[model samples]
Target chain A: MQPKRLSVLGVGLLGGSLGLAVKSVASDCRVIGYGHRRATLDAALALGAIDEGYDDPAAAVRDADLVVLCTPVSLLGEMLDRIAPFLADRAVVTDVGSTKASIVRLSEERHPGIRFVGSHPMAGSEKRGVQFAQSDLFRNAVCITTPTDATDREALEAVEGFWRGLGMRLKRCSPAEHDRLICDVSHLPHAIAAALVTMQEDAALDLVGKGFLDATRIAGGDGGLWRDIFLDNRQNLAAAIGRLRTSLDDLERLLTPESSEALRDWLDRAAERRQAALKP
Target chain B: MQPKRLSVLGVGLLGGSLGLAVKSVASDCRVIGYGHRRATLDAALALGAIDEGYDDPAAAVRDADLVVLCTPVSLLGEMLDRIAPFLADRAVVTDVGSTKASIVRLSEERHPGIRFVGSHPMAGSEKRGVQFAQSDLFRNAVCITTPTDATDREALEAVEGFWRGLGMRLKRCSPAEHDRLICDVSHLPHAIAAALVTMQEDAALDLVGKGFLDATRIAGGDGGLWRDIFLDNRQNLAAAIGRLRTSLDDLERLLTPESSEALRDWLDRAAERRQAALKP
Candidate 1:
C-alpha cells in the first residue's frame, strides 16, 4: 500500500505539507510537486517538501503511483482532468478538497479509468503557503476517504493505507454523506464565524476578549479557499444554517425569566456535548 | 486606590483569582471571602486566595474598605441587598458581572447612596471553582467598567484602579453602552457557540476538527452562569442575534455562482478584520 512515487498537485500549505509528510513516512519514495508559479515550486524545493517540482500537473503524475490533487475545491475537477491522461497504470489518485460529492462525481463521470478516491485530511491552519508546511501536520488528525460503488477496492485500500502511514486516523463514508456531515462541522462553522465577525460593531470589536477571538478564529482563513467550499456545498450549508437558526429560535424562547431552567438545560446540554467531544 | 481590606463575595474562580492577584500586588491588604459551601471557603483559604472566609455575605463585608460581588448575575442584586446595610462608610463596591445595565441600574435605584460601580473583568475560563484560580488570570486581559450618571466618581475610579492594579487593560463606558457592546462580543458569541453545538448531528461531531472546537469552545462554560447572563442581557442579545441573522442572509445571497466574487469579498473582509484584530 506504500506509495513508491507521490505526486502532489498545488504546492500550497496542504499540498506542500502532504509532500513533506509522505517523504517522512516513505523516505525512499520520490515526491514530485506541481504548481503554476515558479516561486512556489522553488519554495517547496527549498523547504524540502518535494524532491522534484513540475509546472505541469500532467508531468507531475507521469510516473507517480499516487497522485494527490491539493488545489482549491473549484480547481479540483480541472486538475483531475489535466492529470487523467498522464497518470501511470495502477496509479491511485486522491484529493484534499474540503467538499467531496462534486469532485467524486466529476471524476466518475469524465475520467472513467482513473482510480480516484476523494480524501479530506481535516488538518490545516489559518496560515497558508509552503513555508508553513510541516511534516507532522496530518499527525493524529482525521483523514476521511469518500468511496462509492464505482470506487476500486484496491485503490481505496491503498489510499487509506497511505493516509494511515502518514499518521492519520481514517474514516470511510459515501461522498454525499461526507458532504452532508462535513457541512455541519466544517462549512457551517466557517460561515457562522464569518457572519459573527461581519455582524460585530466597531465598538464591540474593540472590546473583544479571548472567547470572541477563538469563536471567530476560523474566519481568518483565506477567502478564496472558503468561498469555493461554501459555493460547492451551498445546499448542505444552507440547510445546516437553517437548523442552527432553529436552535437559536429555541434559545430565544428560553431567554425569558420563566424559561430560566429550560435555558440552563439547553446551554448545559451543549456544554456537555462539546465536553464529551473533546479529545482525551 | 488600593483597599486596606477587600471583601470578595463569591470565592469562586473569579473571586479567588481576584484575591490571589490582589495579594500578589498588595501584600498588606486583608482579603475576606464569602461562599455558601464551607469546603469551597476552605479551598480558597488553603490556596491563599483569601485571608478569611465567611458564610454570610453581610459578615464578609464587615469593616471592608472595598467589596467585589463575584456571585452569579442572578444573585448580584440580592448580594448587594444583603451587604448594603453592613458596608463600611465610603467603601467602594463593584462586581464582575458579564452584563452591566441591569446590575448598574439596580444598584443605582435599589441601594441609593451605596458607592457601586459595575465592572466586568473580561477574564476567567470555562473551568470554575477556587482550585482553578490563577494570580495572573487578569493580566493583559481587558476589564470593562460600566459607569452610570448616578455612579460615584470616586467609587468608579477605585474600581478601575483595582482592576488596573491586577494588570488588566481598562475601558469605561456608560452602562447601556457596555451592555450593548458586550452583547455583540461576549454574550452573542456564547449563544452562537451553544447553538452551533446544539445544531450539529451526532455524526458531524465525530468529524469535528480544531476549528470547530475553537469556534465552539465558549459553549463549554457553565450553563447556569450563562443562563443568567443571557437573561439579564436578553434585549441586547436579541438585537445582536438579529444583526447576525442579517449577516447570514447576505451570505446566503452570495452563495451563488453569479455572486462568487462577492462571496470571496465577504469572506476576505472578515478574514482581514480578524487578522487586523490579532494581538501583537
Candidate 2:
C-alpha cells in the first residue's frame, strides 16, 4: 500500500535520501521534509528529494500516513515528543537511528499513544548533508526492523513494507539484538577507527599509506553524529571493545614468542574469513 | 650514474614493480628477476617488468652492479647470504621489506662485505603477485631509506638516486626509527584489521556496512607477508598496540560518564586530523 503522505524529520543524508527514494519508487506518495535549517530543507526540495519543506515537524506529520525520524540518536525522544500530539491515529512511525535499543525504549516511554516501529537501514557514506543524498542510497541495503512484543503488528508491517519498496532487504530482530549485532558490525568499527587515528603522531601523517587511510576512513565522519551513537549505545560498544581488546591481546601473544606457525594460521583464518564476508 | 644491470630477488609485486619502474625511467638498465617459481619470473618478463629471469640467485647477481632483495622479511637474511658470494665488489644491495631494523641488523651481520642499504616503499595493495605489478606503483609514493653509521655512503647515494628516478619522494632515518614509525602507520593498522575481522561472528557478516569493509580491508591481504612484518617488528608493533589500547581506554572512559563535551572534543579532533592528513 502506498503511503498517502510520508514525512521525514532532519532531512540530511539519510532523510533526504529516503525522500528521494520514496519519490522514485512510489509515485503516489507525497514526501514532506522537516528540518531545523531552512537552507537544508530548501536544498532537499530543490533537488526533488521532497515535494514540500517544513520548518515545523508537527505540521509536517499532521496528515502523514508514515513518518520516519532521521535525526541523531540523542534527539530521538525529543523529536518524537514534539510530533506525538500531531501524529494521526493511523500513522505508523519509524526511525533510521543507528542504535535501536535506546531509541525504541525512548519512543515507547515518551510517545506511548503513537505506534512507533524501529528501523535501521545499513546504508550511509562518509559524506553528509542533503547535497550528498541520492535516490538509490537504500538499494540492496540491509534494513533492520526491531520490533518487540509490545510493537503494533500493523505498524511493523507498514514500516518494513515501506523500506522494501525502496529495494531494501529486511532483517527482523529485537531492538536489543539489533544493538548487540550492530555494536560489532557498525559501532565497534567507528570506535576503532577513531582510536586508531588518535594514536598517530602529527609528524608521521605524511608517512602513512593506503592501509592506514582505509583502516581509519570512518574517523573522518561527522563528530556530533558519531558522538551521539557512541554515547547512546555505550554498553554494547564497550563490550565490543572488550572483545577487540582480547583479540588484539591474542595477536600480541602470538607475536611475542615468535610463534610463526600459529601466527600464520591466525592470519590465514582472518584473511579467509574477511574474503568470504566482504565478497560483493 | 645508471647501472647497466639491476637484479631483483623473489620478483613479485614489489620486485616486479621495481623492475618495471627502473626499465621505464632508465632505458639502458637491464632488469634480471630471480624467483623460486619459474611461472612468476616468466610472467614478470612477459609483462616487461624484467628483461631476463634467473632461477639461481647466484647467477642473477653475478654480473649485476645493483641487487635488490624483494623477498619476505623472514627470508631477507637467507636471500642475502645466497647472493653474497656472487655479488660484484662495487654492487649496492637493498630491499623493499616492510620492517627495517631486523632486516638491517641481519644484513649487517651476514653480509658485511656487501654494501647493503634498507629501503621500504610505502606503496602496495591488498592485491599481490607479479600479475598485479604496475610500473607506476612507486610514482609519488613515499620510500623511506634506513641508513646506519656503518652504511656505505656510496651505496646510500645510489639507492636514494634509484628510488628518486622511479619518482619516489624519499625520507632518511635510522633502521630503529624506521621500524618505530612504520609500526604506528603500517604494521599496527594490519594487526588492528586482522583483530577486527577475528572478532566478528560468521552470522553477523551479512549486516556489515562499508565502514566495516573499509576498516578491515587489509585483513584480506596475503597472510604470509603480513605475518612476517608483524613478527619481524614485534617490539615496535607492541608499543603501537599499547598506544592504541590507551586511546581506546580513553574513549571508553569518556563514554562511561556520558561526557558529551569530552567525547565530542575527541571525535572532532580525530575527524579534523584525518580530514587534513587525507587531503591529496
Candidate 3:
C-alpha cells in the first residue's frame, strides 16, 4: 500500500505534514504538491515537504499512484472534479476533509469509475500553513475512513493501510455514521466553543482564566475552514446542538435548592465519564 | 499585613496549597488547618502544608491573626459563624469560594465585626486534596477579591497584600459584580463543559480527541464543589446560558448557503477575539 508517487493537492498544514511524514517513512517515494498560491508551493518546496510542486491539480496527479485532496471541505468536491480527468488509471484517491457524507456521495455519483475513499486524519492544531507542518503529525492519531457501498474494497483497504503506515490508528465506518458521530465529538464542540466565546462580555473576557481559554481553544481555528465544515454537515451539527440544548435544560432543572443532590450527582457522573475517557 | 498565625479551614487542595505558598514566602508564620477528615489533616501536616491541624473550626482559628475559610461554598457561611466567636479581636477573615455575593453579604450582615473579604484565587487543577497541593499553585495566578461597602479598608488591603506576597496578581470589585463577571468566565464554562461531556454518545466518547478533552477538562472538577458554586450563583449562570443560546441561534442562522460569507465572518470574529485574548 506504499505510495511511491504521492500527489498532495493543497499544500497547507495537513498536506505539507503528509508529505513530510511520508518522506520520513519512505524516503525514496517522490512527493508532488499543488497549491493555488505560488508562495505556498515555494514554501512547501523550501521545507523539503515536496520533491516538486505545481499550481495545476492535473499536473500534480498526472503520474502519481496516490492523490490526496487536502483542500477545505467546501473545495473538496471541486478539487475531485478537476483531478478526475488527469488522475493516473491506477491512482487511489482520498481526502483530508472533516465532513464525509457530502464529498463521499458527490464522488460516488460523479466519478463512479474513479476509486475514492473518504478519510479524516484527526491530527492537527489551530495552526495553518506549511510552516507549522510536522513530520510526525499523524503518528498515533486516529484516522477515520468512510467507505460506502460504492467505494472500491481495495481502495478502502489501501487508504486505511496508508494511514496506518503513517503511524495512525485506523477506524472504519459509513460516511453517514461518521458525520453523525463526529458531529457530536468535533463539530458540536467547535460550535459550542465559538458560541461560548461570542457570548462573553468584554469584562468577562478580561477576567478569563486558564479554564475558559482551554474550553474555547477550538474556537480559535480558522473560520473559513470551519465555515465549510459547518455548512457541509449542518444537519448532523444542528441535531447535535439540539441534544446539547437538552443537556443544558436538564442542568437548569437541577439548579434549584431541592435538586441539590441531583445536581451533584449529574456533575459527578459527567466527571466520572470524562475521567474514564482520558488516556491513562 | 503579614499574619504571624494563619488558620486555613478545610485542608484540601486550595487550602493546603495556600498554607504551603504562605510558608514558602514567610517561614515564621504558623499554619493551622481544619478538616472533618483526620486523615486529610494528617496528610497536610505530613506535606508540611500546615503546622497544626484541628477538627473543630473554632479551635483552628483560635488566637489566629488571619483566617481563610476554604470549605465548600455551601458550608462557607457556617464556617464563618463557627469561627466568628473565637477569632482574635484584630483577625482578618477571607474565603476562597468561587461565588462571592452570598458569602460576602452573609458576612456583612451576620458577622459585621469579622473583617471578612471574599477572595477567589483562579488556581487549582481537577485533581483534589492535600496530596496534590503545590507551593507554586497560586504563583502568577489571578486572585480576585470581592469587597462590599461594609468591608473594612484595612482588612481588604491586608487580604490583597497577602495574595500579592504569594505572587498572585490581585483584582478587586464589588461582591455582586465579581459573581456576575466570574459566572460568565468560569461558572458558565464549567456548566457548558459538563453539558458537552453529558451530551456525547458512548460511540462519540470512544472517538474523543485532544480538543474534546481540553474543552471538557473543567467538567472533571469535584462535582460537589461545583454544585455548590453553581447553585449559589445560579441566577448569573442562567443568564450566561441564555446569552450563549442566543449566540448559538445566530450561528444556526448562518449555516445556510446564502449566508456562507456571513457565516465565515461570524466564525472569524470569534476566532479573532479568542486569539487576541490569548497570552503573548
Candidate 4:
C-alpha cells in the first residue's frame, strides 16, 4: 500500500530525512512538509527533502494517506490535536518521537478515528535541522515501532513496511518496553555525558584528549531536544541514573588495596561486554 | 643536544612510541627498549620501535644520555631504583608516567644526583602494547612537563627541548598541579565510563547506538593499567569522583518541570564549552 500523499510535520533532521528517503525510493509519492517557521519549510524544499511545503498543520494533512509527525515529544500531543479534524478518513498516521509510551497514549486519546503508530528511528547526529538531512540517514539504521494490542494490524504492517522500504531494519515492541529500553541505552547516556562535562574542572580543559572528546561529544547535543527527552521519560531515566550512581559508589568503595582484584574484575567485565557488542 | 643513545623502559605503547618517534627524527640516535617480557621487547625491535632490546633495566640504561621510563605508575619507583646504579654520570632521566607527583618525589628521594624530570604526554588510545605504537603518536600532542624547584635546570630544558623536537606542544606545570588536573580530566572520566557500562542492564544492550558507544568507549581500556592509576592518585581521583557525584545529583534533582530551566542552562553551558574546544 504505497502512500499517494505522505505529509511530514516539523521537517527537521528526522522528518526531512524521511521525506528525502521517500522521494528517492517512491517517485510517485508526493512528500509534503509542514514546519512552524516558513524558512525551515523553504529550506527543506530547497534541499529536495520534500516535494512541497505547508505552513498550516491542518492544511498539510488534508489529502494525505500517511502523516508523520516528526516534532519533539513535548509538541506531539498538541500537533495531533491540531491535525485531528483535518486528517483524511482512514489516514494512517505515525510519529518519530523519542519516547513511545506517552506519544502512543496521546495519539489514542486525542485522535480517536485516525490510525496512529509510534516509531523511533535510532539514527541521527548531534547536529539538528533540515540542512543535515540526507536520503541515506535511515540506511542500515534500526527503526523500532511501538505497536500495542489495540493498534490496527493493517496500520502496523503499513508502518513497518514503510520503514523497511526506506532501508531501515524494523523491530516491533510494546510502547512501554520501548520507553524502558531507550531510557537505559539513550536517555541515561545523554544525561551522563552532560553531567560529566558540567563536573569537569575549568583548569583541566586544556589537557583533555580524544578520550574526553569522544566521551562528552553527546553533551554537545541541542539542550531543548534533550531536555524534552529527559522530561518525557523522567521516571525510567531517573531509575537508570540511580543504577549508574550505585555502580560508581561500588567502584569508589573498591578503591582499596584489598579490593584491587575486585576492581580489576569489574573493569575486565566491562571491557569484555563492550568488545562483545562490537561483534556481529 | 640530540641524545646519542636513548633508553626506554617498559617498551609498551608510550616507550615503544617514544623510541619510534626518536628513530624517525634522529637517524644517528640508537634507541634501546627494555621490557618485562622478552616477546614485547622483540616485537618492539622488529616493529622498528626500538633498535635494540634489553631484559635488565640496569643494562638498558647503561651508556644512555636519555632514559624514558614508560612503565605503569606502580613500577616507576622500582625501575628508577634498579637503573640508578647503572645510569651514566650525566644521564638525563625522565618518565612517561600518568601521575607526576609520586614519580617526581620518588626520583628526588630514591635516586639523588640522578637528573630525573616527570612528563605526562597527553596522547594515547584505549589500545595498548608495542604493536599499536607509531612514530607520529606524539605529533602535535601536548607533553606536560612537571618540573619542580629541585629539578636540574639543564635537565628540565633538555627534557622540554626533546619533547618539542618530537613535535609535542610543551606545557610546564608543578607535579602536584598535574596530578590534580589529570584527576579531573582523565581518571574521573575513565571511572564514569566504566561505571556506566558496569551499571548497564543486559537486556537493554541490544538497543544501544553511537551515543552510548562514544560515552563508554574509554571503559574498554586496559584494566591493570587503569587500576594502578586509580590507586596511585586515589585522593585527587576521589575528589574528582565526588565532584561528578554532585553534578549528577544536581541534574537528577532538576528532572522536575519546575527545574527545566535549570537543566537547560546546565546542558547549554556544557554544549558551549565542548563546542569551544573543537576550535583550534
Give the local distance difference test score of model 2: 0.89
Tell me each candidate's i-RMS in Å.
0.6, 1.2, 0.7, 1.1
Candidates 1 and 2 compared: the better one by lDDT is: 1
User: Per-residue lDDT tens digits of candidate 2, residues B86-181?
Assistant: 888889999998989988898888778889999998888887899989899999888999999999999999999988888888999899988988
State the DockQ of every prediction. 0.89, 0.75, 0.84, 0.74
The candidate maximizing DockQ is 1
Clashing pairs in 2: none
Please state the error at residue B176 of candidate 3 in Å. Answer: 0.9
User: Residue A45 CA error for candidate 4 (Å)?
Assistant: 2.5
Tell me the lDDT of model 3 at A237.
Answer: 88
lDDT, model 1, position A149? 95
- Candidate 3 deviation (Cα RMSD): 1.7
Off by over 4 Å in 2: A1-4, B1-4, B24-28
Candidate 1 residue-wise lDDT, A17-81, digit = tens: 99888888888999999999999999999999999998988889988999999999999998988
TM-score of 3: 0.96
Ranking, lDDT, top scorer first: 1, 3, 2, 4
Worst 10-residue lDDT window, candidate 2 chain B: B271-280
lDDT by residue (A9-112, candidate 4, tens digit) is 99999899999899899989999989989999999999998888989999899899999999988999999999988888879999988899998987788665
- Candidate number that wins on TM-score, 1 or 2: 1
